[model samples]
Target: MCCYVGCVSETAIESIRRSTRVMLLFTELTAVLPIFFLLQERRPWAVLGLLMAGVVAIIVIRVRGTLLRLRGLWEPYSYARVYGLVAAAMGIAVLAAVTGSQTGVFTAILVGITASEFFVARPLGVASRHVGIVVALQSAAFWIVVVSTGHGDMVGPTLIGTIIMTSGLAYSVGLTYRWWEGVLKLEQARRDAAELATTRERLRLAEDLHDILGHALEVVSLKSELAVRLTDPEKSKAEMIEVQRLARNALRDVRALAHGNRRTDFGTELTGARGLLDSAGIACDFDADPTALTTSERDLFGRVLREAMTNALRHADPRSCTVSLAVTPDQATLRIVNDGVAPLQRDGEGSGLAGLARRVEASGGSFTARAVEPASFEVIASLPR
Candidate 1:
């Protein structure tokens, strides 16, 4: 198993299946070697026929059980059928003991013990332990029968050594199967987690699109309707111009959202915020300097500015809004202040603001949003230089 770990390019599950199949083939050949040697000794045709039949049956059953288990299709009936074949092989070994053929008895015992390897294919820990105990018991029974029935010529430490070797091989193979199962399960869990994270990101993007485009479209609709009701051509023209601007902004935002490129430049956002505030009939005061900030700092502060502007437009009845940016030797700061603070209608912050705060903190910064005065709402974000 260790030798094959780096020999394949398949996935974990496929690798496990390939390795288990190789192990089964190796064990099958070794189990049949003893019978092949006994035939070289000119054993009786009847004895060879019976021993060959039992060996073939045991191999077929083990192969079938191993395939089913690897495909995760093993059931109670399959398990029972394999164990029954093992019993028949053990019966053959008892017959060999009665017939005074030491080689046949040893081969039968080896095949029966190898059959227990199929039981270890089950995924259950308790079942593997039980199968191991049963194999040990069967080996002990074989040794006792071989010694008691005057077949003691080969019943010294050599007999005990063979039993130990077979039992150890079976146990090691079972443990390796269990270890592979655990690795495959862990790989499956990681894949599931990755898929879940992708799903959540998709949902988040949907929500962001709704929040951005929905607000812009609603404002466009309201302003266009107002322009329609106006009797003066000049006022109607002005309102239509504002509506056009809003439409273009919405389209740009949609493109950015679709491409997963939402990062904003601080200077661009400040200019856009001033335009939006003026178009909405609110006085705008903008103050920012980008010469001292790094690209990451600008991007972070830009997102904060955008979110604050969005919240102010949607949730406040402000007469004026102010955006100010300042950079010192150690840090850079952004503050958005608006008059006419609305009453708090929710107990918690919105996801947009929460996400902004996380971004700010992730870049070694700080964010705060609160009503700084009875009529003024303020948002402050600070980042290290």
Candidate 2:
């Protein structure tokens, strides 16, 4: 069929381009054959009839190309419907006009070409129900014309066959596209589930760290008070040593809390400790400079102090508490001193301290706690920045 050649998809355009060449050659061959054979037999009318058929065929191909171009430019749905309707109408009109002409065969051939072109380029239901309706109607109309004009013998039942074939092909392709879309949706769901799991794991780890370190700091605070009030230097020294060891352990746990692997901050810790203690009416006084520590280091230390302060307020009764923070290029430190002593009857609870101790030392930091005077207890932490 003749069609506008310029506006088609690469695939459709290529098909049209190839078919145009082939159809033109075929039309020329049909035109030449009768002239060569029938003209010599003195059948000029037959030769004329054949020549006119070839001309009509060529014109049909050109028109189809134009329609194909239009089909390509139209949006998919509109393209399908417009092309189907136009092809059907053209086929019916051509068949009706050439009913008794010697070129009646040519008209049937043209109608077949146009109907098949409609199916090939934009099959039934390719775009919408409207496309199917147009194609079906055209096929039926072409059949009616053929039966009425007695051209059905030459044309065969091809109009009906083409409609059925194209409808099946279009339906199958549409179903395949829908299936692929469903698969894509499933892949997206899987990704969302994985992301949710990762978030839950992080929250669990954070909460565990908070629980472990908070318990141990309270124990160190109690022990320091007992050691400070001891009268004998040797006993006091022994107690102070134990206090230092406990403080070191506490710092270790803080490191574990901050890093989960290694590294802890000491400066920010002191400030945090001071605030927690003061909030509890423990009168925490503190000072610290964290210029040498990185943001992570400062934060780790802060967490340890936070644990210490929580313990002081929850377990110990103190008149006043002082917290001091100091940081240097090589080291970061925190000290918390509170007035009053925890009784020695019960062993200090190391609930959160054990975790904090592991945390601090993992980052190459140290913790200490001791008794300073008759009524004072202190917790200290040091970390390598």
Q: Against the true structure, whose TM-score is highest?
A: 1
Compared with the true structure, model 2 gives a TM-score of 0.31
What TM-score do all the candidates reach, one by one? Answer: 0.70, 0.31
Candidate number of the best lDDT: 1
Candidate 1 lDDT over 1-385, as tens digits, reads 4334334334755666677657655655555665664565455689768867876777676566556755655343465664676567666665555554445545544534555556454655655665665566666766777677766776665356545554565565555556545555554555566677688688667656755665576567657877898899998999999889888988888898889987657887777677667666889888788766788988777777777777776677889988888899898999999987756543235777887777778779898987866667889999987
Once fitted onto the true fold, the runs of candidate 1 whose alpha carbons sit more than 4 angstroms away are 1-54, 72-101, 105-132, 179-183, 186-190, 218-232, 256-262, 283-288, 322-344, 354-385
Task: Mark the 10 consecutive residues where model 2 has the least summed lDDT.
Answer: 1-10
CA lDDT for candidate 2:
0.52
- Model 1 is weakest, by summed lDDT over 10 consecutive residues, at 1-10
Badly placed stretches (over 4 Å) of model 2 are 1-279, 290-292, 343-349, 370-372
Give the Å shift of residue 302 in candidate 1: 2.8
Estimate the overall C-alpha local distance difference test score of candidate 1.
Answer: 0.68
Backbone atom clashes (below 3 Å) for every candidate: 0, 48
